[model samples]
Target: MLNVRLSIGISKILLSAYCVLGAAYTYAQSQRVVVTGFTGTSSRVPQEVDAAGSEPVNALPSWEAKAWKGETIHNQVLLQGGTQQQQVSVTAGDLADGKGNRIPQQDLSIGWVKYVWTDEFRDGCGYRKSVDFDSSLVADRIQTGTNTMLIAAGKAQPVWVSVRVNANAVPGDYTGSIIVDNGKKITLPVKVTVLDRVLPPPSQWHYALDLWQHPAAIARVHQLPVWSEAHYKVMRPYYEMLARAGQKTITASITDEPWGHQTYDNYPSLIKWTKKKNGKWSFDYSLFDKYIAFVMDCGINQRINCYSMVPWKIAFRYHDEKLQRDTVFTGAIGTPAYNEFWSVMLRDFTRHLKKKNWFDRTAIAMDERPMEAMQSVIALLKTIDPAWKISLAGAWHPQIEKDITDYCIASEARFPDSVLIRRKAEGKNSTWYTCCSEKFPNGFTFSPPDEHVWMGWYTAATGMDGYLRWAFNSWTARPDEDSRFVTWPAGDTYQVYPGPNTSIRFEKMIEGIQDYEKIETLRKTYKATGDQVALNKLEAALNNIRISNFNQQSATEQLAPYRSLLND
Candidate 1:
């Protein structure tokens, strides 16, 4: 990854990362009584606790853990089936931590007492919500909505009680007072939104290449000293074509090994056994930079620059496999050094962008946030630019959900729509993100989001993500079994009039998607529609694309376990 280390402010970054990641809470108070910041999954408690209490002492207010939410003690697992429970805790900012005060006489929140709860530590290390808060809610996977249950608004979506309540037990709406417990409580009712008409597929999320600039022009760029001409001939042209096809977003990973299909795991290796540079430990991205310039020339919109890799180097050196895997992101590994390094890279990358004048044009993403990494990233971004569009991988240590987001939004105070509503003078209001994504080498892990996040497979709304994405071997004029559009069947065919030799199902998949446009359209316009039938059609259409794409990808995956196989 060629990341710099041990410099000015590195320590500060690390320290902050540690604190922000809940390290402070865990280290100081192992057994914490908490109500806010509970995600159904993908996040964890910095401190560990007991899942069961002694004799099931009662606790009041609503209780929530990752995917499941309830209001009582045994109810966390299930007490009285019909009895209700509420796990009450103070709201953030409403009051300060009652640190150093005498144990005040307790008041039952609608007659509830404090009980013990554990770290829900996914049975081993890191938080994945391996167990359920209640066995009853296991089947409702979609409700997690990307393994998270709620959405929090930053800036001004304040929490106000819609229905009121009396101290005594009664079942009716009772509007009384605002619970100002800032850190303690932050929940609200959601205004469900539905669309009236069908809209066109968004095609800006991806950047494609121009089919016109292939062969000659691209062939020349590959011959330069820093690049492998043949590899350039294979991949570069297609990358360009993908954008030229109106796919506006592109991702350029540095690779030194074989990856999958025509696609090489071509990631820039920061450690040993990398493919390029004759096995240099510290990678040189200079040549890659040139290729990026090529992409820039084509007017690509978004780009994700990642030197981020699992720190196999550190994990092996320290002899901590868990740390090693965490280095690669088994879960959250928030630490000061991680934070320091993360902020360092982000800061440096931000600087590089400014120098190249590509800073404002693209939305930069910091891949896979390690606890340590995010600690520094959050703080650094706050310092450098609070408004910087940032993102985190869905695989961090968390039982995290809407509560945690609620906490983050409240603390960060920025709304999702705010990014959508920024004024011209303010800057771009585009906030793009993905959650619970399939791991590159492995298939998908972690639970899906609360709802079926409409795999919006177009260029714009989804960037380069689409159900009918087409990938042929290469874009060279050379005729080969693998290539998408080749020369010969001859010059004019490959040049002036590009065409597909055989109708590879790739086109059929696109047609399938085109056919599905109606289903998607209907999904938007009507309120009460047929769910099962529409799902079946959507599934059939989507699967046509998935199965087709996978057949191609599975083939790609097999060839080069590392990278070069695709390029060569």
Candidate 2:
């Protein structure tokens, strides 16, 4: 059944430019809806809109008012390696019918018609993480939409606008507009001012962070049976998001169940291991090849961390040819049979990586395990090939630190600061990671934006090469009920929700990464000019950046005095 409605009323043309006190502007279209330039913090747009009454809204602060035609739209700053976002709220119009009553929310038409891409800042961060933007690939017009919503008259519906100016983007004003399809032709101006600086490419990100990717969790969240083309469609945006965030490592699983949880689990295995009727081990890499290629295709071309040649529980099941049945093996790492199985697997895997030109970029990665397990696995890996790269994310293991290609230190562990600084100097990767340990500097929902933004600064300050947080899309079993699972903190499980919609924490972390780049930029300037004062100011700032806590610090306030200096 098709439903339609018709309206015939006195033609009214009303225009009012209302400016809010301070840095906000609102325009009304015949009292039907009003829009004010807004900004998104760590919270989602809906939450921001719903809480608009009690909380003060934020907008892009204009350095020069004359540059803006309307208060809501104009030049916004996007540092070369950073992300900038703006929001506008569409509210019920302030018009009255003949009966002196306001119009209903259902009458509002906030459908965005098209986006005008002008100049070099042509890329748009796709709506709600639905698609990724690559600047090399330009588009004439971008059509955007939000969920179907009916905002009541006088109530505001916030719309999100995000733009990522590429590191190589020409530094200038890129003009554009959001054209609304309402009866009134309203155009909102968009001018992105790209700065002159460069974000490191994925391969040289300097941070060897590995935020684990779980295909199974995505499948469960979207309620799809098995990984199909539909699963790929649901999954691409997430990998793309991480890639854009300057993520360097690719988390790949080898076989099913990953050596733990001998019961039902959802973690997808890339390899289908089998023993044929001829009594020889055989393997399939179809899915493994596809997923890695997919992630690389999403623009994450960097080190590949194939996880857990050894896991905690130390067990797995495989088909046996002689018995013509499935067999279970439960034992420690480097046992004869265990060594035999992994020998073939790792050798073949290395060959596969070589075929794909990922051999030097690949690492045999392992999770948290005891020192004995680490030693055994390291030994077994050496037996496979002395030159095979290895990655381990766990407690401090000094005996093996020099041998490991990448050692991801846990936040709780203490190693002499000089160890990592020296390692980084030697072109070795020294990084840090945090899981469900020490509550400080973690990315929980309740954790302040300062916590998220401080991580990158701390990494750079401590002279660590990179940082890692455990999960990308590892959603809770009952993500809908609450993202918190079992005993973990409310947001410790994941930084992003199902829609690939970012959390405030994720956004703040990106802010911190940009801050780190700014610091690097300043250091270079200081070296070239022999500016001791600039070096002194950087030292003073670092004094406030304690690893244990933010101490309620404001990242913006800390960076304010140095912004122009670094840019200069």
Candidate 3:
């Protein structure tokens, strides 16, 4: 009996030792590096290892995305020209082995996602608490130039991978892998299934994207003098980026501080106005010509939207050659002074634009002005040159609807079917714009990333020509660092960053625009083939996409079915 008892005790001790060894082995394995993939439309905020709870390994699942040829798709990975984006999250455990030896950081193929201070405006719009509210650092800009990232122990890092499927890529399943080298190779597999249909390139797409540009913002952010050679050199990549997204309008301010200094960087006039000593007005088109030519060279040659015959403050500035100083003309719309002020400049400007062959493409643009004021401006523009094209981003007024060539109404308003049809027939463009006034489906930093892409689909469903946004790069003081503003919600001022870096919001918006192009292409092909069945089905899917549905469903959820149908 004593021998049997001693044997039982030895067996129990051995069993307990084995269990302890097994747990240690398992924990050591878990302590190693981990990589997971997520969709580009979804943004993953980095969480501290401690705050991520006891299990951070299972935070996300694998990544997969579908796209059409020539479509730009966003995941953590991106594909353009048949592009898709895929985002990969890398989490490090203790960064040491069970033996306590340190492990090397990984090499990311694309770049790391940078965190920027962002405020959660939730569903509110226009002027809210900037502090003492729900605010945190959100991962946004993808560090384009860097190819490696160092993740601290117990923290995670996100990497953005963009893959461009050639425009002529065959329709089939394609597989690729993102390799993370951390001494030992960690492979993250990427799978993409390209649909049979083709999406036209941005230049050919019918969707007219008009994201207003603020060149001064770019100059300020880069610490370069406005319009300097260095400024132009730096501005090239930025404009080229805009061109890639199918931007249709060139935003030019004819008057100083066009919008009453609403942006962080005041918009200096592109065209210099000079009043001569002999009481005659002369215009200098040197800067205007150079900027417009530069933008056209960058591939955004569609339309030039010159800001305001009526500026927000009803004030105009000119170089008084007589006084050898700058002068401001404060004249209300339709007044004698206002009429005289614009008439001389318009006549000379018209002649100069005609000389450059830019008159036909140029529009005297206005934003959110009253109907009465717009009518007065339109009348004045016609008086200067009946052939003048006009553009307005404001409430739709039927009284002056026929006069504006590029009419972008507020998202809250819609153009009547008859009016839209007439404008389409007249070769005029009608679109919609969203700003701080809107809460849901905006490009605010706190807003869901999917909303940016949703705007493209909404434009397609509503039968609008395209979409317009006020500020493409109206960047705040430190846009790359923080996205908050005193006047509006976070990210309201800009979309892209200083490194000329692209944001998840911006990339996802491009994805949505590509979707829009795909929809348009499919519609045209089906109609030409007399495929009424396909047309009806497509229309049905689009009809279900309503702004009202935003609350009940996510943009991804709404897009999934239509994407599946397209893939089929």
Candidate 4:
């Protein structure tokens, strides 16, 4: 039997009652009957009704999906068939399942899109990705829904991301492609030049360098767009050696005292005071002075992290020993004892110089103590002079880790954009995380946001970071000694593999030169005017350029001697 119910409106019945009654009798009597009816969402509008009328009695699932606006009209009808080779037709408001019953078509359109995809990645792997864009310059009425509507195919496809635009847009032609995969990308080109308004520049880019990066990172940096690759031959020696020693230093060791003594506690004045007072620490700059001289002579930017305020003997216990009473940090660097000591120490460190009147230029900043100790140091330094750039370094864990990250981000906005973490693959009976940097045979863990923790290069490329720390130099070239380096005086020998010397000087040099130039440019352009926005943009651009695979930090060292000219 065929039952069709058609109501045109609240008061009108449009379905042919006579035709349906006769069809029901025929359907009940037929043998090979073909029953067909339309099934889809109905809209209460004259135009949508017309479109529904245009649809065929039977259509494919793919062609039957579309949306129309008007009013609510859930159409329903049914065609029952009992005959073979016999056919019955109906409109979209009708449906039937052999038993002459109407069925809902709601289950047909499954998993439809609700928003358009905006391309954001560049063509390749590491380095190039996010393109600089002003979120306020969108030109079109953006739409988001379960349908994907694109006017073009292949390369002509739109690649631009969208942000709701406002009236004050300084418009002009804006265009670019986001890399999707190798040789595949979507592009959106727009021309919206406004009258009498200046559009932001497409981008401002710069190179970056960190004087203490793995040489592999340095050699790789040379491939970025910002690196002056043509002039990178000067860093050739620095990088080539590292590249040749491509193997990683899988073992990492940290001694209680990397320098074998308190930073400035060995000077004549410090020694005299300590000797007379029976102190555990003294103030001295003999080694510091020599280190500064060596860097100046090497003509390389000096980046270093000072380990501790208290002597290793007094601060961290040796092999889990108790803190000795006689220590450098007997609350002597602070008040009642002397306030000038800490401030004077930094002041003198910054001001100490050779005949050229140039003190050692340092960028590495960190204090490894708890937040309270760090805060005291910061406060004292700020009072004595607020110009010194100080960064706190400590275990990136628990509450203290968050404190460190928060302070760095808010105080200096210096989060590293890229982090390289060496994670060991999981295997049966293997219970350890293996990275190329260090070996913790006894099992060591790093608190995150520590420069050494891996976060990939994405965060760095987008101005969320300013430094990356993965420092390990293969000391196996010292051959007979433990390749797992512990630096000097004492050594930690937990090692996995043996290899040639792994010096990352090349990478460090590259980072240093690039960053120096970048900061210098910012100072030149915005220092006098105090353009924070411009400065932020400059920093962002530099960060992006730093992550680009094409960056040329390998050529960094050779140009350092001439950077002063560029600064001028």
C-alpha RMSD by candidate, in order:
30.7, 13.8, 7.6, 25.6
Q: Sorted on TM-score, highest at the top, how do the candidates line up? A: 3, 2, 1, 4
Between candidates 2 and 3, the one scoring higher on TM-score is 3
* Most TM-score-accurate candidate: 3
Residue 172 deviation, candidate 3, in Å?
2.5
TM-score on alpha carbons, each prediction: 0.32, 0.70, 0.87, 0.30
The TM-score measured for candidate 2 stands at 0.70
- Which parts of model 4 have CA positions greater than 4 angstroms off? 1-286, 302-329, 332-360, 394-456, 464-466, 474-568
Question: How well does candidate 1 match the true structure in TM-score terms?
Answer: 0.32
Pairs with steric clashes in candidate 2: 31-93, 31-94, 32-93, 33-93, 42-504, 207-466
Deviation in Å, model 3, residue 511 alpha carbon:
0.9
lDDT of 1: 0.28
Q: Write the per-residue lDDT of candidate 4 for residues 1-568, one digit (tens) a residue.
A: 1233333342243246666878886755444322122222111011112233543333111111111111011111212223233222211121222344322232111111111111221111122211331111111111222222322111111111211112243333222211122112222122111222121211112222122222222223344321244323434444333222221111111113422432211111111112123423333455344433433333333233343342223332221113333334334434544445444445555554333344222322443345555555556656744544443433332333322321222211223323212111110010112122232111111111111111112233333323222232221223222221222111111111112121112222222323333355444668678877766755554444321222332222223233232122
Candidate 3 residues lying further than 4 Å off, grouped into runs, are 1-31, 46-63, 77-109, 122-129
TM-score winner between candidates 1 and 2: 2
Candidate 2 lDDT over 454-535, as tens digits, reads 6777776777777887777777665433443444545565776666665446656766676566677667868899999888
Model 3 worst lDDT window (10 residues): 77-86
Q: Model-by-model lDDT, in order?
A: 0.28, 0.58, 0.77, 0.27
